[model samples]
Target: MWLLKKLSPDFKTIADFRKDNRGAIKRVCREFVLLCKKRDLFGGELVGIDGSKFKAVNSKKKNFNEAKLLCDIYSVLFLMI
Candidate 1:
């Protein structure tokens, strides 16, 4: 609930939302995946080669530009769309 509230003021809390909201969230996620699949936007057939533990929103000094930033930005934008 803290997350939903903090991220969206309109949503006071997750508990304040109905139990059935889970279905809506799941459906939206599925629809996004389907859309990406249709657009052939899924890149990198092989992953998990680096084996480096990194924070998503950490300082840029520790993260790679062409590698980490590009991947992170794309993932975030894809989810938002």
Candidate 2:
């Protein structure tokens, strides 16, 4: 926290730093990942599960089911023909 406060760079400075060091950062990250792999640090199977529940803001009127989607597709196809 103290370090962050002391070297509190603006958005432009942060962006420029990242842009300039993009290649070097990528190389460093690749090396780090390779080192971790060599040490068997990662699991055999990586399972990423995002258990995030989002509330549906759209009402029934604004929502479209499979049947409605199929109907719309067929209507467009027929119109094109």
Candidate 3:
């Protein structure tokens, strides 16, 4: 087929290209998602957040704070004596 003048790339070349531009690919994906959302493709509200490291729990209000950290440190020090 006479689609273009450039020759077809081999598997290794394709793989290396992907490995080198992974971040760019992810950003492009995010932009595509935003464009789709602007076009009202999500049907309802769409919240795109990268929360892989966060855990959803009932004790969210009791999460880490300076007072809690200091209390834990004091308790551990008292236990060691």
lDDT of 1 at 49: 67
Candidate 3 per-residue lDDT, tens place, 1-81, comes to 367566788899999999999999999999998999899888786568885786656575767889889999999999999
- lDDT (Cα, tens digit) per residue for candidate 1, span 1-81: 686776654555655564659788888999998999899999838655678885687565765767777888999999999
**Top candidate when judged by TM-score against the true structure:** 2
Task: Assess candidate 2 and give its TM-score to the true structure.
Answer: 0.49
Output the lDDT of residue 27, model 2.
Answer: 97
- lDDT of each residue in 1-81, candidate 2, tens digit only: 696887777999999999999999999999999999999998878777899887877787778999989988999999999
- Scored by lDDT, the top model is 2
Q: After superposition, which runs of candidate 1 have C-alpha atoms over 4 Å from their true positions?
A: 1-11, 44-61, 64-81
Looking at candidate 3, the ten consecutive residues that score lowest on lDDT are 54-63
Can you tell me which runs of candidate 2 are displaced by over 4 Å?
A: 1-5, 47-81
lDDT of each: 0.77, 0.91, 0.88
